[model samples]
Target: MAMGRAHVSTDRPVAGRFRPVEITHRETNRVRWYADDLRTGRPFLVTRIGLPPDAGDAVRRAPSRVLRTAGIVSRLCPERTATVVETAVEGGFLWIVTAWIDGTPLDDVLAGEGAFDPVRAARTGLDLLDVLDAAHAGGLTHGELSPGEVFLRPGGPLVVAGYGLTGTTPAPRLTAPSYAAPEQARGEPAGPAADLWALGAILYALCEGRAPFRDRGRFEATLRGVDRLPLRAPVRAGPLTPVVQGLLCKEARERPTGAAVREALARVVREDTGVAPTAGPDTRPRGGHSPALLCAGREVSRRAVVLGAVPAAAGVAALVLAATRGLSGTATGTSSGPPPASASGPTGSGPPDSGRDEPEPGGRGAAPAPTGPPGSAGLPPGYRTLHAPEGFSVALPAGWQRLDTSGVSGLAYRVTFGADDDPRRLAVTYSERVGTDAVAVWRDDVEPLLRRSGGYRRIGGIRATTYRGREAADMEWFTAADGTRVRTFGRGFLLGGGRGFSLRWTTPADGWAEPGSREALRTFLRTFRP
Candidate 1:
């Protein structure tokens, strides 16, 4: 049985909602409770951290900041972190409630199992490195990582907690003084480098069966030792000694990056386990037109487009891509005709085309066809055709140009296009890695991530349909940018055998129903040829 600093009487509820059952774990200023939600009658893990008596504004703002950060990180790396259910600050206590995780805390595992072998430690290090890579790419740092914050599922990956607790207290080392980096102990701001140091500390604890810097009787004393004393050599680290030493360096500038750490840990795992490192999902073309051509579109890949503008939006893109395996075999066609008067709803086949010279919705007639090039014959007025070097082509409105392109070598790539001062953009993403069900990819895999976006609300439920005579799904949602509400329509379809393509069109929500926006969407759907 574990002992806690704070006792919970059975009759008294902590926040008038959670009924504490037992103390699961406890640290210097933190306690974990196995509690039940009075409203839902579901079990949850509630953690309470003591705040300083004179926390000032931190007391008022920490609740929202912590919740928001937890939400963003949970969506970005769902498998790597626990889902935060709620947070509150009352009576000098910051209460964080998360979904009950059925796993053993790393601290408990260390206590019961003693030191882990080098291969096991290296494997755990790789998992931590991947999570850190995602968080840092999104500009977040898990500054308070320690053995107690990590939980290992029976056979699943590690899940981290205590993400939003950093920077909430005045003291540099609020709870875990021994884990603080040298810079943090010196009263400096914690950054990505600090996370690296903490990772090293965790690695050390796993192999050595104790923290690099043992906790002194006082917090200040331990932090001082961390700031001044050199790291003791690891006696049982085996292959992990080099990485542990590299990460525990006192000089923050000399620490290796997350990528470097991943490489080193992977090498160690391979050398010790006698098995090659597992490869991630393959995004390479299985069997398509060789030398894929560039396609006309707007914005860059989801990362460059949304991350460049709104950092959190990258979470949405990453979630969608990571959920699926390869691109579908549903290839688009080179059909051409007059644009639809209004945007058609989700359809089962290629985009509907009309030959009539009818006026578009919102009282605007289609612009006259541009007389610039030969392939432009079938394009709508003011639109021209672009054939990319990647073996794909599409028609784009005049003034649209390729903004950016990104992907792994020969596996997957995304091309974006738009013009200066344009509020609307289109992104074409091709992947050799996608799942089987187009609808499930959108609903189960992508929507959870999108929910984290600010002002994110789906226009309607995800609709299953067909594109270019192949299985597809359409999802529409609204988000805010610079105080302007923006809308996006995504069409993802399978091309068979783990190959797929997705077309995302975004525009100002206020103009979503206008003639021009409708025409642009219809034209792209009709002209795109994969």
Candidate 2:
């Protein structure tokens, strides 16, 4: 049963049709090859996996079992899972043929790029959890999930392979023993929890640059290590440390459910604004097809592919929770206490709103010129630096004191500043999770919600701009609060690593053009530092 290492003959086509042309990737007991369909002259990825000698009737039914499982999973996950073209069993080996994936394997990406930053890894983990969530919900399990089975497209959702081969043999796991869950290592039935464990292992590998359990030379030995070894603490997982630890819990019952994992991963994705788009070597086969740029009617953003199916409420909650927690690490707060987070404050005091509003003073909402050097320096008359305990500092008018503090504790926070009864106010918001598109955050996410608030009128189109060399956007609007018309100018900027800040300056709509009011907007933007 080719147990030691999988071997394939290059002499002839497998099933008398598919011919292996090049070795693509290899795991403990599996090998992936770039192959050609002799009859169709089309390129494909064919995977060969070893089977136990005593597999008995399972070997006879392997082809059908693989096909059935693959079909079930493909329907559950759609483009997120690989498309299985055919399955076959010959010479004590099971062969799986799938359409050529137009991307690099996850392992190959790690090899080429070394250990990924925690933010990028969390983004990938979120994508993987999406497929797992769908499969588990449909009562299916991905028996063998490892970096080798995951394919990452440049600007699209990742595609996973090796769906149906897990139960085709009596052996607990067919390949990548290091990724096997403890139950699988003990020769017990694997369930959705097992897939979650593997998902954690993959996340660990992506951040640490190695599998949680090292693969011993022999498959049996590797499984033994997985079953008995103590896990090495993940030093680089950062905020994802808890998630990796929760999923790797020895008892399957103790591991977090797929939904819980999704929530945590999504939170991480939202909080880390520094994650650049995932990049890797060009692994697309010669004459191979390019990956589809459009996913579910929207063009994929270069940062990450957000699942369209995720509940809107859940997304809003993530933002709210983040803002409620505020930017503890990267945020500045009053000395009395740190700022808490949320989404309900006036413009620039919380999240910026997008869409049409009254025409701006400049006719296009252009920001006025700076009045002083950045920080507390060269202040015009009575301005002073308000140093916040949360780690950011900004210049504020003499009468301005922290008006409100709201946040969720860690996700994000917003602090408003104003005189007790004054019509002018300044709001500073720090968020750990923010979209790369500053314009979209305002127009798409923030604006829709603003429209529902009382008498909200936008000034102009959300304008894309740069602040201190970082990607940023600006929006202005008017809103009636307690029968008073207030004009607010908001500017939000990204600081990478899923972290960002927004400054909102508000005053009586009729008094927005006063020299003092104009200076406050410029001073806040120039002096603020997270």
Candidate 3:
């Protein structure tokens, strides 16, 4: 059998009672193990943190401080924070023992999946703010709040860990320094406001698949960037943009208070009906595993619940002309609106009604010659291969043809294909400027712009997947065209060297489960080649 992940180098019993088993989770500077209490024969979660070698009196008194702080916070936030069982200092490390929490760490979830949509991110922020509110009211600061410090229980509930370690060391922050507040990075004392900054960093990572500031590999270098660098504007935050930017203000005093942050997140939850319902009381035995994580009391497959952002949400409605638009300098031509049925020419500039048959500059026509097999192999009925001059090919339905194409030549381009009567569309986008991380590109670059389209609601989280043996990601969502709800499934794969291609298949939401629609999508992904 495969061995479990090990965190500490030795298997020696801690405090001569608790014995570390295997590492259950890991973060920047903290590690959690599935440990056992030798005396009581009970399982526990023992978190280990390294301490400064020469902290003198502070190092000696760390255990007492931890117990005192945990007691204060637990009384204020009952059932929302981990219950500390014991603490001990041994071998220059502080091991905190707590009741085993039956949940997965938030960072682990994000790493396995990808980024969450704005609605879900806002809801999670609200859940986190509840714990912060209670702790702040009790005059306690969770200075080490990070993705690792938070756990997402089955059924959409949240619990926080790692309290009482705020002043354990002389360092401003220990683990996950990328989340340290600007003041904390500068060695200033942390307070409630600093926790708000960490909350903002978590929200940004949820929405964009990355922290506001990149980790510089070295601890000091990362802290310097957190203190000195300006935050890159959040693109996928959408309505939550204001709240994230506000909490990340360099000056702690400028960050929004707990009440303000709560209200903003609540408003977003109220506006978006996609929020997962809060799970009811869990009756599972302590330290026992559930067959599958339940969400809203439904018995969904673990893959569906873990990989998806819960069930798909009903998307918004809007006729977005951006479907045919490409990244700047990636393709040629500039035009808006879906092409008319009879229109058969290269994409042109100006309004949709420009009535011009502008041919591509390089003697290309409305439908470029196929560079690959002309016949559909292993394709659905009536599908044929139409290769493009832009170095990619895919199978299209018999009546389908190039409806619109746009982009700057040699950089990036987007080509849309569809039939006049069919509401479904397949848009292929190729870009040399695309980022290496497919999840980041979808969460940070594409979704933000899509949010601008009216009535757009993402169905699930951005999921990391593989396509044609390349690094790829998939996103599914709902949008509207003339009051009709439409669903779109987009898969983007990296071609190495910052180049990538994405295929987006859109159909009416009502018809998404139809056999034809499902088969068409599978056929597209199977036959597409670059």
Best by lDDT: 2
Candidate 3 Cα deviation (angstroms), residue 513: 46
lDDT of 1 by residue, 1-530 (tens): 01123443445565688765545567667777656566644446778877766667877788887888888787667556777777887666788887765444666666644787776777666666656656665677888888778865422355788888778766665677789899999988899899999999999998999999988857678888999998899999998899899999999999987657777877886676566555222112342311111110111221121111111100011112322322211111100011221122232111111122333321112111111123554345789988888777778999998876767656877677678777777777777767776667777656666666567776545544444334555566666666777777676666667777777667776775566766576456546666
TM-score of predicted model 2? 0.54
- Per-model TM-score, in order, reads 0.52, 0.54, 0.52
Minimum summed lDDT over a 10-residue window in model 3 is located at: 361-370
For lDDT, candidate 1 versus 2, the one ahead is: 2
lDDT assessment of candidate 2:
0.64
Q: Which model scores highest in TM-score?
A: 2
- TM-score winner, 1 or 2: 2
**Poorest stretch of ten by lDDT in candidate 1:** 328-337
Clashes of 2: 32
Q: In model 3, what lDDT does residue 169 have?
A: 73
lDDT score, candidate 1: 0.61
Q: What tens digits encode model 2's per-residue C-alpha lDDT throughout 209-282?
A: 99999998888888989999999999999989999999999889999876577667766766765443332212
Model 3 TM: 0.52
Comparison by lDDT, 1 against 3, better one: 3
Cand. 3 Cα-lDDT: 0.63
